[model samples]
Target: MRDKLTTIGFDADDTLWHNERFFQLTQAYFAELLADHADHDHLMERLLAAEKRNIQHYGYGIKGFTLSMIETAIEVTEDRVPARVIRQLVEAGQEMLAHPIELLPHAREAIEAVAETHKVLLITKGDLIDQERKLAQSGLGELFDGVEIVSEKTAATYAEIFDQYGDGPDASMMIGNSMRSDVVAPIEAGCWGVHVPHGLVWEVEQAEVPTSNPRFRELKDLGDLSALIDQIS
Candidate 1:
């Protein structure tokens, strides 16, 4: 299987480096910032709703998330959210954009090992600027043969990407944390999907594990990827 694969796509955010954890931390701060306006639980509900609603409009990443936070605050406070709170929200987003890139354990090692014999690509959907910034800071940019910052991850999108890269679905593999984007979509596109569990996943990215799919694989971490490929090969 490994020998048959000519290209491997890796999801950038939580798969290669820390991402959702920062969002989780920022959410905690947001909850505290609006504690006086609404209860934590209610505020969280509103935030989730806002994100889902704004996803199509703003797409994914920090800018959209920051906008959703502001929208949620306004709604939760009945349009009475303070200017200070808004400023704080903007600052939180800026901080996230400037956050250091911390690669997950064995991420570089795994990528390097795989790249030695495969064409590795970074496939991530997010605000273009922020994603590029993280990739630059991650210091692993050179490891990938190509980088794609897409608007969304879907079966059609995966198929298009594979075609553009000159690799058929049967010769492509996608590895990531999101079952919806990384596993199901790619598998649906006829590519192999490998799920590497991450501790913190955004609610919108969540989906049930596809254990029934023959092309779907769940690994404990990126560290196991090489072995899995070898075994399958």
Candidate 2:
């Protein structure tokens, strides 16, 4: 498998470092801020809906999520959301954007191990500024041969990425925590997909594991990635 795989792409968020957990923390804070206006569960549902609808307009990242929080507040409060609450929402997002990067267990080692054998690319989606900042702060910036900060992860996006940086789909593999973005889509693009389960995954990113797909694989953690690659290769 490795001989066939000339390029290995890694998802930057939960796969490389801590990301969704910070978003979850901010969401809890958001619920607290809007507690007087709506129930936590209801507010969360509205926020998710708002995020999905706004993804086309705002794309993905802290900025879009912060906007969604404000929009949800307005909707839940019937447009009576307090000015202070809105300010706090914006502050919460800023705090998230400024948060420090914390690499997940074995992230660096796995990348180093893989990089020794193949071209390693950091393929992530989000606000370009935030993603680049995280990469810089992660101290793993020098490990990757390339970095792709994309707006969305889809089959076409994967295909394009492989076309530019890899030896076509058959010789590329994408590893990440999201089944939708990391596994299914890349496989559909004609590349292998590896799912490394993360402790925290956003609701929107969750999907049933495609265990039946021959090109799909799931690992308990990235620590096992090197061994898995060696086995399959």
Please give the lDDT score at residue 188 for candidate 2.
93
Across residues 101-127, which tens digit of lDDT does each residue of candidate 2 receive? 999999999999999999999999998
Q: What are the per-model numbers of colliding residue pairs?
A: 1, 1
Give the clashing residue pairs of candidate 2, or none.
Answer: 1-233
lDDT of each: 0.91, 0.91
| TM accuracy, model 2 | 0.97
Q: Which stretches in model 2 have alpha-carbon errors above 4 Å?
A: 1-3
* lDDT of model 1 at position 94: 95
